[model samples]
Target: MMKVLLPVDGSEPSKNAILKGIEEGLLEGKEIHIITVVPGIVPVEGYILSPHVDDTNQQLAEETLTDAKALLADYPNVVAVTRKGDPGTEILHYASEIGADLIIMGHRGLGTFSKIFLGSVSSRVLNHSECSVYIVKS
Candidate 1:
């Protein structure tokens, strides 16, 4: 069973990647791992974040994974997880730890216009990951 890693963020581009992968039959009978990473934003030294902030993020992450899974309902061997850290690094780590054979993700993430010149998470993973990477353009 080959392991596949897909990093999602609730963005339309990310959702497009997921749908595109399915259309390409890339996830058939594979052990698919769908993951979403939430930024570990800590309040400044003098500031404090409301408890609901973290709670809301977690809830949203869960919902995103659940919806993604539902989209691939025909596929049985699938798992969803949430992580906290730098998205690119965390995705690479998760793929390595799980022995992923391929990394399928969106070409664009939730970044600003600066991403057009700088590298996006997909670019970073493509450059850094040891495993094969497939970029789905939105």
Candidate 2:
């Protein structure tokens, strides 16, 4: 009855994490917590807003969660959710809130500059998360 957090960003690396877990027998029959964090709206008073981007972000988040949930359809104890904010922060917050014992995520995400210079969201979560983190390399 242990809890495991799976943060997916619709990336191959993220998908591999799930596959790795299953192959390693770590997530085969356990309850899983899946989350996809959409970048939150950053309003600029002087700039014009595109309604399309706002709606699209939320829609994308929902779709990502749906797809991720489907990946684990055989598991009955799965909880898929979506949040808005910094991906790393939200992932860790959700893990802490739910008291997840382990977190499985991708080594890198859609980030272009971050994963090159310092680290990606996965690295940030590893540094900040209170629980054990397993980062699946792409």
Candidate 2 lDDT: 0.85
lDDT of 1: 0.86
lDDT per residue as tens, model 1, 1-78: 999998998777778888998999999889999999987777689877788888888888888898889888899899
Task: Give residue 94's lDDT in candidate 1 (0 to 100).
Answer: 93
List candidate 2 segments past 4 Å from native: 44-46, 114-119
lDDT of 1 at 107: 79
Highest lDDT: give the candidate number.
Answer: 1
> In model 1, which residue pairs have backbone atoms overlapping below 3 Å?
none
Estimate, for each residue in 15-118, the C-alpha lDDT of model 2 and write its tens digit.
88888887788886678999999998899999988989979988888887888888888788999888889998999899999999999887777777644633
The 10-residue segment with the lowest total lDDT in model 2: 111-120
Which pairs of residues clash in candidate 2, taking residues 3 or more apart in a chain or in different chains?
none
